[model samples]
Target: MQIPVNQKFRLLSMLGEHISMCIIGVPLMGLSLLTHGNWGFYFVLVLYLNKDFLNGRSPLKRLLNTQVQQTTDVPANEWQCFLRNTTLIIWPLEVLVVAINGRRRLGDYLANTHVANVSEDIGSWKKELAAYRVTSYTFYTLLATGLYLLLVHTLFDWLGF
Candidate 1:
């Protein structure tokens, strides 16, 4: 089935993903600070790589009832996942491609991946609520924020600014 990429669905997915990241990131920052920065980069890297861009159903996609799928009706594999995520890393280029092609970009074309709306109430509310609980987010945010501050401070101090 061809996936329809509705603008509203895309926007909702982005918002949900951002909120989820913030929920996880804050405590990650704090813990990184406590550990002297070693875990910070690792945390960020793991989160980015392991985040479900195709079938894992990222928080945003879950909220929007959307999912990324292969054009062929087959589930996405690891390489497809990596390529699809490249859009996040090189977003400007991806955007340029999408704009030039009228919304079809390299990642979509090459990976045979497209975003489609799934059935809206697929147990998503319970998952999101669990994710939203303050306790679940606190540790991650603290770790991420603390490490970010530490890095900023170190950079300024080194530059004598």
Candidate 2:
């Protein structure tokens, strides 16, 4: 299906959210491995599920100047947000549905919400874009640091040093 230009931005924002989570999550996974706990996975899941909070603008949406609002012109409540995100647990299906319908995923349909750009103002978008760059850089730095630590630990173990 052909998604409109604006919907494409929403899709990109959603994808970016997942990618950012992974950037932070990979390091958390390494920590979980070293600590022998599942908290890292749980923390990621919570963040994913709650990504529509903060007055209809989650971190990812804020970065992209997008907001998830109900079709009724009201902010989506927590229940709606959670219901929509439940499909995220089975991400392949969620992504497939989104690919088929850019305007609304299964979660959006279920929750009666859709993502829209917050405004047409260039200034808002520029500010959000700047923030997005910083967020991306931070995530990359954390991922790289985690990888380095894991490598050093492995090397020490291998050499018995």
Candidate 3:
């Protein structure tokens, strides 16, 4: 199915949300391994479940000025946000549905949530694009995680672990 240009943009931004989570999650996984505990995995899970925790938007969505609202066109409550993400645990199915059905995934239906573009103003987008705080953190964390994994692999190989 052909998604509209704006939906495609929103989809990409949402994908970045997953990437954003992995940026921190990988290092946390590494930590959990070294510490011999499941804390890091649990933390990542919590993050996924609560991606829209405080503001009904994930980090990437917040950066892009989008929001998850009820189908009635009000900002979704915390529970709605949480409910929507629960279906994401079955990522393959959710992704498939989204690819065929556009930006509203299965979870969105179950939770009665909808993705809303907060502003269509090019100026608003430019302003967000200029905001380095979110973008930089995601980029740098990904870079750092790459370096971290490489270092850990080298150390493990050197030690014959």
Q: Candidate 2, which ten residues in sequence have the lowest lDDT sum?
A: 1-10
In model 1, state the lDDT of residue 120: 70
lDDT of 3 by residue, 1-161 (tens): 11122557756866787789889899998999999975686578667866875446676776777777877766566667777876655777876777887778888889887788765342443463464244343554445445544665576679996
Please give the ranking of all candidate structures by TM-score, highest first, separated by commas. 3, 2, 1
Q: Candidate 3 has which clashing residue pairs, if any?
A: none
Poorly placed runs, candidate 3 (over 4 Å)? 1-5, 120-161
lDDT of 3: 0.68
Model 3, residue 156: C-alpha shift (Å): 26
Q: Could you tell me how far off, in angstroms, the CA of residue 87 lies in candidate 3 after the best superposition?
A: 1.4
Ranking 1 against 2 by lDDT, winner? 2
Query: Which stretches of candidate 1 lie above 4 Å from their native place?
Result: 53-56, 92-106, 120-161
Listed in order, each prediction's TM-score against the native is 0.57, 0.67, 0.69
Of 2 and 3, the candidate ranking higher by TM-score: 3
- Alpha-carbon lDDT of model 2: 0.65
Q: Whose TM-score is higher: candidate 1's or candidate 3's?
A: 3
